[model samples]
Target: MKMKPLGRTGVMVSDLCLGTMTFGTQTSETGGHRQMDMALAAGINFVDAAEMYPVNPISKETVGRTEEILGNWNASNAARRGDYVLATKHSGAGFSHARDGAPISGQTIPQAIEGSLRRLQTDYIDLYQFHWPNRGSYMFRQNWDYDPSGGDRDEVVANMQECLEALQAQVEKGNIRAFGLSNESAWGTAQWVRLADETGAPRVASVQNEYSMLCRHFDTDMAELSAHEDVGLLAFSPLAAGFLTGKYQGGSVPEGSRMSLVPEMGGRKSDRVFDAVAAYLEIADKHGLDPVHMALSWCRSRPFMTSAIFGATDEAQLQRILDGKDLELSQDVLKEINLAHRAHPMPY
Candidate 1:
């Protein structure tokens, strides 16, 4: 459980961040609390949530339930409220369940922070992130046919300036300690960094994006941006939505698995995906490593990784992931992994 600096904020967070997307839905409150205890015992000091969470199948009825569960934990452990770093997101436009699908703007920053603070039962959020760009994003498998030609340049920059000004106000108000982004592009992040430099707002500390053995979109341009800008990546879906666990191989969809609940696996399922999985699974088998551990270890080895975010539907699964928390890949294993990547690139 090595600690790393979260960009330029001077805040040290665990290399592994506990993800709570399934809280209040697949996992009971007791289970979520127990998982937190387990994570803390294992030295994980970072946890992440979103306002539109519990999202295997997001619904209007369950909006904000995850934050409420976390709030309960905070109340029960009031003495240890300062023990961990908390991160949450503001849902972007087209999320119908929140704010009637409104886009993020200067006016919405304080309102969203107030709601998160009340629900989290905390004085200030360690990291407050925008769930996605209001103009739109290429994340969540949307990059295949993405087009950037429709955006108005002047309007985008103006909105960013306004939002940065509002975020600066929130910093003064002690509502949030740091700011971040998710599902954003290299160009978008560059603009935010430039604006924050000029406006004296909270500099972007991190960006949460999907990175795994099967998904390596962050390895190129985004990786370069992180190297120079100091914006570390909080990697989500490091297991490729559980595909790297080999539970979905041979066309087998286990009962109550993510595939069973959402058949498309968030646009990750395809004929090439299984073959790619098989290749990596073989590499793990050859080295006598658990595929889950291999995938997670590989993510942590990246130069731009701040933390690898992982979630479990049950305590047993959580414990299984924690078992390999100390495993480090050898240079030989890493070499084979690079070869594997060349053989099968972009399976999703």
Candidate 2:
């Protein structure tokens, strides 16, 4: 439960952030509220949600339900609203349920913030993030053949400037305290930082991207950017979509598991994925560690990691993660993990 600075914003956040993607879907409102209580008790002061959530099967019907559940908790705990840091995202283009798939622009920033504020029952968001680049992103396993050749450079910069101007207005109006990016690249983040600095808009405080033992995309360029630029990574999917938990090993898709609900595991399933999972599982076994703890601890060990965002479908699962909240990997375990990474990189 160590606290880390949310970039240079001077806001301290827990090393682990409570993720509420499954709220209002896999979890009941009572369960979601209980998990928040448990997280607060565990010293997790940061909670992350998106306007488009409850996404086992993201749809128009369930859009914004997760935020509504969080709002309910906020209403019930009005006195403790300041007890935690609240962060949420604006869904990018192609998210059909929000604004008919409109790309993020100056006009959309205030509208999105207003919706999130109303749904969250909060005056200001601690960290407001763009769910993804409107131009497109390589996150969610889209990096394999990602091409940036089609993008218009001038148009992209212009849009970023416009968005920054709008974000600056929101900051003055007390709509959001800080701004962030998600599923963004090193170059994209660099532009945001540059623009924010030049315009005095809220400097990009953090970048939320998927990072785990099985996924090492952030280990290179983005790692360098985060380290040098102070844009700490709020890593999502640190468990590799539960693959690192070893529940999907030997083709065993347990009932109610993510794999069972979404067979492809968001395109993370592959022959090499299982092989890579086995390797990490062996490392955990050899060290007498719970694989879930190992995966989460590994994420916490990274220099660029600000927080590892984790979600649980129920209180029992959330308790298991909280029980291992303070497990730190020894040098020997870390050395072995490095070796495993070299042996099997990018399994998906």
Candidate 3:
């Protein structure tokens, strides 16, 4: 339960963040609440959610249910509101369920924040993130075919300035304390930082992206940006959607598991992914480490990581990860991990 600074925002968050994406789906309301209690008891001080959550099967009908559940928790425990840092996201383009498929322009910022505030039963968010740029991103297994040639540089910067203006207004109105991004590239993050400095808008506090043993897209350029800029990485899917936990190994999908329900696992199911998981599992075995613990501890060991966001459907799964929250990997384990990464880079 180590705490780290969330960029230049001057807010401290736990080394591990509790992810509530499964609040209304895969996990029940009571179960989600129970997990929150356990997370807090374990000293986790950061909680992350999104408007379009419960994403095992994201549907319009259940779009905002996750935040509503969190709101309910906040309403009943009003006295504990200041005990933790709450973060949520504004969905960008390609999401048909929000604002009738509106993109995250200056026009959508206020509305999105209003909706999130209403649902969360909170006056202000500790961190508000753009889910992804309207320009699209390489996250969620889109890196292979990813193309960023859609927009002109000046036009993109202009749009960012407009969004920053809107965000500055939010900051002035006390709607959001800090700003962040998700599924962004190093260059995109730099642009946001540059614009914020130039326009007196909020500098980014974090970047929520998929970073795990199987996904090292953030290891190089993004790592450098995070190191110098102080925008620490909020790594989602630190378990690689259970692939790093070895649950989906040997083609055996456990009953009620994510892969059993959503076979594609958001395009994470592949032969290469399995092979990469095997390599990590082997390393863990060689070092007498639980693969789950190894994967999570490895994430926290990164220099640029502020927190590694993780989710679990039940308390047992949660407790197992919490038990290993303080594990410090040996130098030997890290060496094997680098070899594994070099062998299976970008398995997805």
lDDT of 2 by residue, 96-141 (tens): 8999889999999999999999999988999999999988889888
Candidate 2: clashing pairs of residues: none
Return the number of clashes found in candidate 1.
0
TM-score of model 1 (CA atoms): 0.99
TM of each candidate vs. truth: 0.99, 0.99, 0.98
Q: Model 1 RMSD to the real structure?
A: 0.8
* Runs of candidate 2 exceeding 4 Å displacement: none
CA shift of 222, model 3, Å? 0.9
How many backbone collisions does model 3 have?
A: 0
lDDT of 1 by residue, 264-316 (tens): 99999999999999999999999999999999999999999999999998999
Q: After superposition, how far is residue 10 of candidate 2 from its true place, in Å?
A: 0.5
How far does residue 226 in candidate 2 sit from its true spot (Å)? 0.9
CA lDDT scores, all candidates in order: 0.93, 0.93, 0.93
